[model samples]
Target: MSFLGLAHCSLPPQAESLRQEVREFLAGALAGRGAAARAQSWDGFDPEFSRSIGARGWIGMTWPRRYGGAERSALERYVVIEEMLAAGAPVSAHWFGDRQTGPLLLRYGTEAQRVSILPAIARGELFFCIGMSEPDAGSDVAAIRSRARRVPGGWELSGAKVWTTNAHRAHSMLGLFRTAPEAAERHAGLSQFLVDMRSPGVSVRPITDMAGREHFNEVRLDQVFVPDSALVGTEGDGWAQVMAELAYERSGPERYLSGVQLLLELVRAAGPAAGERARVAVGRAVASMVTLRQMSLAIAGMLEAGANPAQEAAIVKDLGTAFEQSLPEVVHELLGVEPDRAADTDLGRVHAVLLELAPCFSLRGGTREVLRGIIARGLGLR
Candidate 1:
């Protein structure tokens, strides 16, 4: 029952229409003055770009209309995400909120929490980061040691989160902290809290990725106070809640397109000499990407049907990350460019950045090994 068995859902015509709309919007993005510049749009952050996405009613497109969303099918939002990643628009500003946290909140958050958070997220006025992986727990989310003791009106949180993407700029973090000792129940005592990054006891320091981007951060919480209502779902549903969240995280187009721009660049640069090898490589890559899209959309359709696509999502992530991570080497071989997209003013710079950032593809949502274990368990192999 992993991925809620979304290995089976279908797409409708409106998905293509959404893709066209996104295509047109991105085309006009460069025509305007002071157009936002970005090195890598997915990881790149631009408040204005995020707001524009919101203005189009594209952000949270699958959510209910009462919260400023279009109430569209999840398949439509899938198209929007596909186009956004292909265009490399600066979506990191609202990435987590639009991609995962909003959906997670809609499912598990209290009504008050939904009303307060969903609209702002839809408005693209706020940003969110994950506070799941700790220094010791990295991929072992069940091993998270960030403890939150019950206080008068709320919880007192004291713990550290590492590799929190965009924590320096996020308005809040969907933080995972322990409410009871692991000695009681490994997963029982866990809880999720909406921690204000600007709170008095919260400290955030940026971590620079190899691409010279300050996207990741180390977040320290020292007795930060979060109200009871800030808690998402029940007191001890963090593990289940987060498992659902990762499905949203890994099944998106972002997983497949992390290296797509470079792939597109390679295709263009291939020029008159796209030869059999280059043609085969690009064609294979595109086919894999398309299949990934179809799989992801199927999962989205399942979500629309109120099913959790965790297993479907795990397969998509493992495959998509491989496609994205392989683009650098594939493009380099096809284009005969030097391995150095890290340097500005060179065609290789983008490819180089993709190479440097490739290792993180599997690490972000969940480790590859963790995802495979879930898959194996789903297949009754474990």
Candidate 2:
């Protein structure tokens, strides 16, 4: 039950050098992009942009060279991701694959599966979505009712998943399903599989958010048949595997950088002669950003050292999302400006987009209540 300390973890010189290289690349790549468009943050999707990133060897920076990765340190990957996020690069096309799916395969997939899928993912030619949350079960992943029954040569998957990000555009999904009847143990029967999105019975219905965007989807699987090789790791090991996967999902720069575009606008809107309250709000937000970045970096260091920092990741996500969700309110209060999506100014447009999208920051990786429960259990207070 050891916890991560608040001490800062410094990135290596190579990582810093790579940071500048990423910045230069992003400058040319993201030029002429408006603040409103950039406000999408990691949710922006562009296949061409993702392919370009792959061409630069930035997509799978930490994976082995045999798998089309640069075999760089996790901290170097961190620098590249943070720079892309800050510049609002449209990375959603390869986001899930680079962030979790590729790593999951490296850790749990068969050698053949790795050889076949990892290289395409590293090349940014294949995209993936996570299929965990269902209509009945959102944050409570163990309660998923999707069933995968074994047939002669494959498994038949049936059920529906809600709030699935990128399912409409992704080529595949790393889905969780029930392989056995529920036992006294709540997590015993769950299993994971790699299901191709193009499978005959799979269908995706987009779910529009308050921002009028169709990033989330409801995916229905009606007896979708996946070959036996699609199974990830051993059966009944999905609980542990998915828990590890969540550590990757929750500890990234996207947790804290979601509101950065609006934050930059806030600073611009508040000139040198601003009131004390406005200055104080901006300063407080900056402080939280720096602290969260330090915590996330420490978790990256732990991951590099082969440690599972799930509890620490939960803590960072909870605080980071709270920071993100609060920016719009703070800006509205301090600047006395209402959000205007159709406004011509960058401040109005960015603020409008972020204000509409802020409520989802806490809901994406894991809910706030779920995150706190994880923290409580880790602290032996539950």
Q: Which candidate number has the best lDDT? A: 2
Query: Candidates' lDDT values, in order?
Result: 0.82, 0.90
lDDT of 1 by residue, 214-308 (tens): 87899999999988888899898898898888888877777777887777767766766778998899899889987887777777777778877
TM-score of each: 0.93, 0.97
List, in order, the clash count of every candidate structure: 7, 0
Candidate 1 vs. true structure, TM-score: 0.93
On a 0 to 1 TM-score scale, where does candidate 2 land against the true structure? 0.97
Per-residue lDDT tens digits for candidate 2, residues 106-171, read: 999999998999889989899999999998898888889999999999899999999999999999
Which candidate achieves the best TM-score against the true structure? 2
